[model samples]
Target: MALQDRPNEKPEASPADLVSSLAEASLALARAASEGEAYAALDMAAHRLAALSSGRVSICELGMSPNGRALILWQSSRGGLSIGEDSLFAEWYTRASRMGGEMTPARGHIWYGLLSADTLNDETGIRVAIFLKFDEMKEELAAHAYGLADIAAAVALRIRKQKAAALERRRFDGMYETTRAWLELGADIVWEASPEGILRCRRILNRRGDISRLVDGMDLRSLRIGGGGQSLLDFLEQQGSVRHMRAHLPEDAQGRMSTGETLYVSATARRSPDEDAPYIGTFTAIGRDAPSDGTRETATMLLQMRGARIREEQHRREAEAMLQGLRLLLSQDSSREKMSRLVGLVGECIGSSDACVAEKGLDGKVRILVPQQKSPGPGAAAALDFIAAGAPRGVVGVYDIDAAEGRNIADAFGLEGCQVAALALPLRGDAAFLVCVTRRAEGFAPADLDFADRFALLLRQALLLREEQSHLAQTAKMAALGQMSASIAHELRQPLNTISLAVQNLEFLLESLDFDREAAAKKTKRVLAQVERASDVIDRMRRFGRKSVGEHASLVLRNVIENVEAIMHHVLLRAGVRLEVEISPDVTAYADQLQLEQVIGNLLQNAVDAISGIGAKHERAEGLIKITASPSPDEKGMTVLRVEDSGPGFRPEIAERVLEPFFTTKSAEHGTGLGLAICDAIIRESGGRIEIGNHAAGGFVQIVLPRQPA
Candidate 1:
């Protein structure tokens, strides 16, 4: 029957009955196997409390959500009644509990009491809530409600602890299974030995039946067929570890014992300060082999091969890293910047803070290319001395400052104290480059020296290439200058002749005794203008002949075209070729100005030569050369300058070879064949190219360049 239907008079609970009911609840909870059974036992306890008080009592287990924002009614004594954190009863109970009052309720004659599970603490966020319904609020009934709630809290905490333990046990079981399977698959035999090198436990993982009994309880050291080397126990005692140590079993009296079989053992053990410790290791059986020296040699060779493979892999990775850094260094636009970054990259690769590149000149003086300073550091002097002594060419030398024999070498490199080391690699000739790297630690290994040698060789090749290019460019420039000398002489003679005439007129006017001052002044101004004009021609030629430093900047197309036209005008006039130039003043390109001038002049000269040849062949033919510049139609962000001539286009058979170095159509005295090749190189260096082709009008040579940004 429901408690509300009971007599109005509250029945007082006897102490013996309450104690018996508490004992029954505790007994039920102790025997509970799962959370459901535990909850059921708590429910019975709540009913017993209600029966004792003759009042309706409800027990609810409350837990915080993972986010701790709301209460969860995990379990309850009453059935078919839902209570949420938002409910009026729940809100009132929560507030009353915090306020430390038991009188607050949302319904008639209802009182709330909170029970603590101190063991659960905040980690579990679990507590018990009891609601009691009576005709009036009584202290005795409130006490009973709290007692039931306490029993429920204790049961819940016990269940949670049991669940946690079970989960941990399952996790460990999975780990043990995984580890056992891994060992069985990967190891031939796994073993453990006592401090005295006696076998404690050994597991053979072969597919064949167990043979472990044959060697059970035997001293592991007794299994080896000893020669003259240290025993396995000695290795373990000294190094605390052993790897790939060869051992063999004694030959059986039968024929099988005569055949040689070996075991490869590897082990690691713990060591204490005052005593030896037991060890665990692995052993793999090797096939039959010849006894003694042959077996040992084969094992040694195998180990060496393995070590070589590992070292080779390491070297490949390091080489790749160094190559990547080198590509970045080469991308730099300035020579000085590239040199500075080169030294930095070398230092990083060698794990040193001091590195430099020095050039040994023919005059026997060494100069530092990087750092851009005159003074040398500690190792710099020693490196220079080695270079001066003609250090073995193409070989990297390493010196340990701490060694007696190496002390002199160390002093040369400026290494003063012990432990520091220096590495020097000289280029192939007496007058060549030297690369030095110094570490303030132990000497460099053979592999490091090898890498440094290779890097130095690469630097040498690059320098040699740059020098050859410079020489070829200078040669081509001088050739062009020589070809233009005749035209240039005639060009200067015209102004000089005009100045001479003007001077003679002034002198005659002054000596005639009826000299006109205005006329004389006019003659004098004419002479001055002629002199200035002659000076301008010489200045343009001088600038064009100057060497290029390979710096790029925006260049006005019209200005460069005009400068080239001035140099080539007399040549064209003397050859009877009409030159037409069509270019806008605003059109610009990104390139070295002097190099661009050289390229344009070379093209104009070639056109003049081609048209002159055609004229010589056809006596009545008109020679015409046209130069035009504009933004390229086929490529974005590019400018095209075309030099077209009204001459017979290149011969089909020789067209492809026209730009090749040392490949020329003209006789030896007329052309050196480097003019077009040099022009192509200069254009390519500026991130551009030259295209040779024929249009309907005649042959055209186009200079394509990166256009200047607006």
Candidate 2:
């Protein structure tokens, strides 16, 4: 090798100089390696290389042996036509082949090969690649190439490490700053209290950040810990331990803790202390102290659920109390003693002053059995009392005691102040009765009302039963009166008729005597006819008012019209009226025979009265009374008795009230008011109907009775 071919060697270069130059280059490369740069950094390399190789650029790359690639090989390239294998690619390849290693056949001088983005040595941040050469001498390539590659990898690794270090510092600082702010705001504070049922307190912070005394005491997300507070020592109860005493405490949205006292902190989560993966934290804090924000959120959710359960429990208690009252009212019995006990029990249930019961009395006045309230009407003197009475008026009613002036009725009744709300129930018997209650301020809820209503219903049914019983007793009285009147009328009829015959005989015997005798005989005959008419009326009343035969029985009504006709005949004749009867002998009913005759007779009598009224007072007709009986067309073989009269006809109200007992427009002496009542009872007992209305011809009273079984 000619030294002159080395081209542009340093003018004063020497071996000593070369050592110094190499040393400089080595230092620069080392510096560049630390800074992480490659390839183009060789420009700096070349400047240093000039000290050794002068103007000639010498390069090296990895090489291969004759057998093929080897783990360690070297190659070099000479610039400016200074090599036997002159092409930069080929010459470098050959030089590498000559090294103590093997190389690939590409034979390139350029030191380039496939390189991976992944650092081949993660710890070193070094990326690995096959070392090929371009324009480099074969012999020394591996040595120089590796040195360059290693230096470059070192620089990249250093840069990556520096960046990571800066980021870690920032994150650590962030955690600390945020936690400090939270603590300053008193949003969170670590709590340390002993488990001795004692209240000793302290703020805690460990190596890993954790804070407590917050809205969510042990919650992770809500924990405002300094940078890294969670540590194992926290698990040993070095700070504080949970008290065994259990209690409910309000918690925030995180379910951790709230400002409310008396809350227990039991569960927890923490952050991992590993700095490399800073996102992780250690979770040493249990109840009052927890680190992670996520844990706080979860705790809050649980607290909300607990709160809902508590509310449900409270409602259940209220509902249960109300149901108990209702059950008590429904189970009691119905006598006054039983009733009194019931009212008292209910009053206690509702916390009331008094429960009073009153029944409307027989004389059309209200009476008080319980408490004995005095006097029937409003003029009565009493305190704290209520009244109930039967009237000619309408159905049931309710009145407020407070509105009644000055008498202190409310005070006496325990219903005066705010402590008094009262309810009165009308009894549902023959006549109405009342049950009044004056309650305390809590008043009565619907539950109370419902209970009272049920009790009232019971009393109502009982009262109605008693009334029915009394009505039954009255039936016998009615029957007795009817029988007495009928017998009197029957007895009176024969005597009166006998008297009339005697009077007629006397009139015949006295006709030629003085005018005074004729007048006396005529007047006597008139009196006899009046007596007969009165007797007939008595017969109808007696029969109509007779008591019911409770047992079902048969009756014969073929004689009803005949008997009724006899009663009416004298009246019709006196009134100058014509009476006719058209009825089947076979006509009968499942009725008391006397009752049937009364009904028939009453109809005939009513017709007679109407007809007599027409020509005399409201005057128009020479009246006719027609009685007819036949099988009713629509019934299953039933019978109908009809009495038609020529008269001014019937009034609406009169016809309406005709069947009501003790109701009549006639004078007291003239009627017991039982005529139509008795008639109705007779026909109704036979499962039949009695109707009075104006006929197309004039006035009418028709009775339709069911036929008796053959």
Q: Write the per-residue lDDT of candidate 1 for residues 450-480, one digit (tens) a residue.
A: 6666666555544554456656787788788
Off by over 4 Å in 2: 1-546, 550-552, 566-576, 614-616, 651-665, 672-674, 708-710
Candidate 2's residue-wise lDDT over 1-710, tens digit each?
21113343344767576556545555565565323343334434444444443334433222223332222222222232122322333333323222212232222222333222222222331342333323444334345445544554455556657765677567656755655443332232333222221221243333222223333233233332233534222432243322222223224433543333222233222233432211212123333454334233334534654565456544443344334323322321212223444455555544456645544433444454343232333432233233323212222233344455322434443333333333344433323433344444444555455544444554454445334433543463464344345445555677677677767766666775555765676767677777766665776555455543222345555575666565555556666778777767766666556556555655655566666562224475577877777777745656777788887776764655666778766555445666676666545534555666787768787776656632
Q: Give the TM-score of candidate 1.
A: 0.45
In terms of TM-score, which candidate is strongest? 1
Please list the C-alpha lDDT of all candidates, in the order they appear.
Answer: 0.63, 0.45
Residue 326, candidate 2: Cα error in Å is: 22
What is the number of backbone collisions in each predicted candidate, taken in the order shown? 5, 74
Indicate the worst ten consecutive residues by lDDT in candidate 2: 275-284
- Candidate 1 lDDT score at position 600: 87
